[model samples]
Target: MKKKNKKLEVRKPNQEVRLASNVYIILIISFYSMIGIMTLCSLMLLIGIIAFKTNNLPLFSQIKTVISTIMIIIVLMFLILYPIKNTIEPETKLEKDAFIFALNRLGLKSKCELEKLNGIIHNLKRDRLHFSSESDLYRIYLLLENGQMVDYLISLRDLKQLIKIGQKVKIRNSNLKLPISGWCSDHLSISVIDEEGKTFYKFESYEPFNNKTKLKGRKIVG
Candidate 1:
C-alpha cells in the first residue's frame, strides 16, 4: 500500500509537468507560425524589390503576379481560420497576475491601466490586403491625455466600407513601446471594441506621418 501511494503521487506531478510543457509548446508554436508567415511574405517582397531595381522587367512582372495571388490566399486563410465572434477566455487571478508581471518586464508603461480609446476612423486606405505599406493605411489620430495627440497607423483588411470617420470605436491591446518603422513592427496586437463590447482585430500603423497617404501597400516601405 505504501509503494502504491508513492507511485500515485509521482504520477500526479508527471501529469502536471506534461500539461505545463504542452501549454508552452502551443504558445511557442503559435508565435513561430505567425513569424514564419510574415517572414515568407517578406522574402517574396524582397525578390520583387531586387527585380525592380535591377530592371529585370520579366522577372518582376512574373513575381508580382505570383506574390499577388499568394497574398489573396493568405487573406482568405485568415478569414477562414480565425474565430468570427469576440470571445475572451476567463483567466484565474494567478494567471492574470503573471501576465501583468510579464508585461511589466517588457518595458510597457501603464501595464495595468491599458485602455483602448474609441476614435473616429478617418483617412482609410487599403493597400495590399496582407502586408504593410509605405504610408500607414487606416490612419487615425488617437486623442490622448494632457491635450496630446497620438497618431496611429491602423493595419487591417476589409476596411473599405466596414469603418468610417465620425464613428466612435473602442480599442484594446494598445502597446506604447514599439517603434513605428516597418510593416512588421513589434507593436502589440490591438482589437477594436465597439460600444457593445464586440472585439475585432485590426492592425495599426506605427510610422511617422508623411503628408502622402496614398501609396502602394507592400511589405517593405522605402
Candidate 2:
C-alpha cells in the first residue's frame, strides 16, 4: 500500500501587516512629540493672554496689532524653545567645565585636543550625539589600545554601555580574573573595572548628575 504524503505549509509574516505596524509606531511617537510641543505653546499663549487681560493694558485695547504681535511672539518662543531647553540644556557650560575638570584629573585629553572626534554610530550622522531617549544610549563608542574603535552596543545592558562617545572613560583594570570556585565557578572570565570600582550604571539605575557627584571624562591609554 502506498503511504499518503502530508503537505507542510509555511506561514510568513504579511508585508502589509509589518508595514502597518511600523507606521503605527511612527505615528504614535510623532503624535506624542507634536502634542507635547503644541500643549506647551498653547499654555504659554493662554497665560500671556490671561495676564494681559487681567492687567487691562490700554495697548491691548487700542492697538490690537500690538497684542496680536505679542501673542505670536510668546507662542513662537514657547514652541521653539521648550524642546531645545529640555533636550540640550544638560550639556551646558557648567557640564562642559565639569567634564574638562574630570578629564584633566584623569590625564586624558579633551575632545577638542583629540585628532578625530566623531559619532560612534554611523546612523547618528552627528559629530556630537544627543541622547534624549533610553534606546539612543547604546550608540556610544570608544577607542581601543590597538588603534581600533569599539562600540558600546556589543552588550546592550552591560557596564560598558554606560560610556558615551566623546566622554572620557578611565579603565582601571581590564583583565580582572574570575576564580573557579564558589558562586562564580566553572567559568573563566575577565572583568573590566571602573576607576572607582563601581559597575557601569544600568539604564534603570542611572541618575542625572547633580551638584554632589560630577560627571567626569576619562579614556584608557595603554
Candidate 3:
C-alpha cells in the first residue's frame, strides 16, 4: 500500500504538468481563434455598411452600433497585443557574422566595424512594407561595449540626406537629378560634396538597395 501511494503521488505531479500544458495550448488556440473571428466580423461589417450606403438599405443605425462595438473590440485587442507587436528577434552569432560578411562584400566595410563604435547589434528590425519616405523606418538596437543599449533608426534612401548636402553646396537653386536606382542601397557608399563641390564625408551605412530578393530575405542567413 505504501509503495502504491508513493507511485500515485509521483504520477500526480506529471498529471498536473500535462494539464497545465494542455490549458496553455488551449489558451493560445482560443486567443487566435477569437482574433480571426473578430477580424472576419469587422471585414463583413465594413462590407455591409458599404452595401447599405450604396443601395440605400434601411436599418443603418443598427449597422452603425455593430461597427462601433467591433471598433472598440479591435482597439482593445491592439492594446493587449501591443506589447509583443513589432518585437524583433535577435540574430545568432553565426547569422550576425554572415550578415557582416554580406555587408562587407557590398563595400560598407567601415560601417560594419561595430567595434570602433564600441557597440554590438542586439536586434534588428527591417520595414517589410514600404510605408514612409521621410522617417528612418528600419530600426537597429545596439548593445554598447560598455553595456548600455541604444537604438539607431536608419533611412532606406539617401536622397533626402544627399539633397541636404546639395543645399550646403549652393546647388539648392540648381535642379540636380540623381539616378533613382542610386538613391537606395542597404549597404553602399555615399560621397557628400562641400561648398566648393569637393568630396566631403564618404562612408557607408544602411541606406537603400534595389535588390528585392535580398531585402525581403534579410532575416534568413546561412
Candidate 4:
C-alpha cells in the first residue's frame, strides 16, 4: 500500500494549460454576453417609456435621471467586478507544484544544462482529437542532435515551437523553487518563443523515446 501510494503520477502540462485557457475564454464570453443582453433590454424599456411620456416635464426628467443612474451603476459594476472576475486562480498551480516535487527526486544534473540551447526536432507526432474535450493537439517528439535522437520526449504548447523537422529551436531558461528540497530547489524551467513571437511553456513530464514502432506509427505521412 505504501509503495502504491508513493507512485508519482505523470501528467501532461500543455493539456492543463490548454484547458485552463479555454475555460477562461468561455467565462469571459459568457459574462460579456449576459451583460450585453441585460443592457439592451433595459435600454429598450427606457426608450419606450420616454417615448410615451414625452410631454410630461417631471416624468421626462425622472426617466432621464434613472437612465443616467443606471448607466453609472453599470460602469461602476464593470470597474469593480471585472478585475475580480479576471483574477481567477491558476487551474494548474497544484499540478505544477507536484511536478516540482518529482523533479527534486530526479536530481539536478551537475553539468546537465537543460536551460538554453538550439536544437532540431527529428520525429514529431501530434494528435488533437485523441481526446474529444481537449483544445490543442497532443504533441510528443524528441530533440535531435547531429541526426541522433535525444533520449527524452520534448513537449511545448504549439507546432511553431518545432515548425520544420530540421528547424532550429532557441531555448531559454527559467527557475522555480519548490517544496521538495525544503521548498528551495531551483529546477530548470523553460518557455519557447517561436519566430512569430508567440510563447509556449515547457510541459511537466518527460518520457523515454523507447518505443520505436509506436513512434513510427504516430508520424505524419507526407
Candidate 4 shows a clash count of 1
Candidate 4 or 3, higher TM-score: 4
Q: Candidate 2, after superposition: displacement of residue 91 in Å?
A: 41
Better of 3 and 4 by lDDT: 4
Candidate 2: segments with Cα more than 4 A from true spot: 1-16, 52-56, 59-222
lDDT of 4 by residue, 95-175 (tens): 333343334334421112234444554555555434444334434444634344542333334444444454444433333
Kindly report which residue pairs in candidate 4 clash with one another.
Answer: 179-183
Top candidate, metric lDDT:
4
Steric overlap count per candidate: 7, 3, 6, 1
Residues 1-222 of candidate 1: C-alpha lDDT, one tens digit per residue: 001111111112344444443443344345446557866876786576555644746776767766775687577546533432111111232222232233234333321123445454434444344355433365455543334454444543444454454444444432222111111111233344455556543443232223332222222111
lDDT of 2 by residue, 1-222 (tens): 111222211134345434443433343345456658776866786676657654665655636745575678677766765664343222333323332233333343322111222222222112224434433233334554445664332224334444443443332211111111001111111123345654333211112222222223233334
TM-scores of the candidates are: 0.27, 0.21, 0.26, 0.29
Index of the highest-TM-score prediction: 4
What is candidate 2's CA lDDT for residue 60?
51
